[model samples]
Target: MIICHCQSISDQDIRAAVDWMRAADADTIITPGKVYHALGKRADCGGCMPLFLDTMRQCDSFGVATAAERPPILRPARLRLAQAR
Candidate 1:
């Protein structure tokens, strides 16, 4: 279940990274670059992007948070402005 042949990243690696990221910051947006950084690797080719994203989404905490769930920092600027006012 290797997701990225170029980086030698497996599905398990992706999942572990995702889970760790979720645990570290529930409000953080998980991306391929972040995953690569987490695993101490770099993206060498663009071919694995689609599959990489798929594997990331498979994780339980891999989507945009609802309005209520979103951290204040992640809220839309307009929403923040309204709240501030």
Candidate 2:
């Protein structure tokens, strides 16, 4: 269950962080760095990245919703620029 040994981060911790971040800002993109920051920890060794990412993916709130799922106003700048062109 421990995803990052260096940071003493567990799968549950990752999930909780992800959930909290999503709740705080629904449109914010969740990343490993953000998760670490949310947990008040930082990555030491780079080895845990693979497992860390896997754990993040398993979290329900980990993935950002696709353009179709998000409101038009919330779409990324690139998408809006493409549309404008």
Candidate 3:
């Protein structure tokens, strides 16, 4: 299940990278570039992006939690007033 032919990356490699990244930093956003970096490889042709993204999406720890799962950001009252003005 080679996902990126240019980088010789397989589905397993992608999954393993994703898992490792999630374990290392639970809040870090996992992207294709990060996956490539984690695997010590880089994208060459850009043709595998579709399949690469698909494989990444299939991983259990591939995505970050929705806004609901995290605390809402708080802006200063002065900033809010400035924006309103």
Q: Rate the local accuracy (lDDT) of all candidates.
A: 0.88, 0.85, 0.82
* Regions more than 4 Å wrong, model 1: 64-85
Candidate 1 lDDT: 0.88
Q: What lDDT is obtained when candidate 2 is compared to the true structure?
A: 0.85
TM-score of 3: 0.74
Clashing pairs in 2: none
- How good is model 2 by TM-score? 0.74
TM-score of each: 0.74, 0.74, 0.74
Q: lDDT of candidate 3?
A: 0.82
Instruction: Give candidate 1's error at residue 49 in angstroms.
Output: 0.4
Can you give the lDDT of residue 53 in candidate 1?
94
Question: 1-85, model 3: which lDDT tens digit per residue?
Answer: 9888888999999999999999999878788999999999988999999998998888888764443343234345555566558
Q: What's the count of clashing pairs in each model shown?
A: 0, 0, 0
Q: In model 1, which range of ten residues has the least summed lDDT?
A: 63-72
Ranking by lDDT: 1, 2, 3
Give the top-scoring candidate (lDDT). Answer: 1
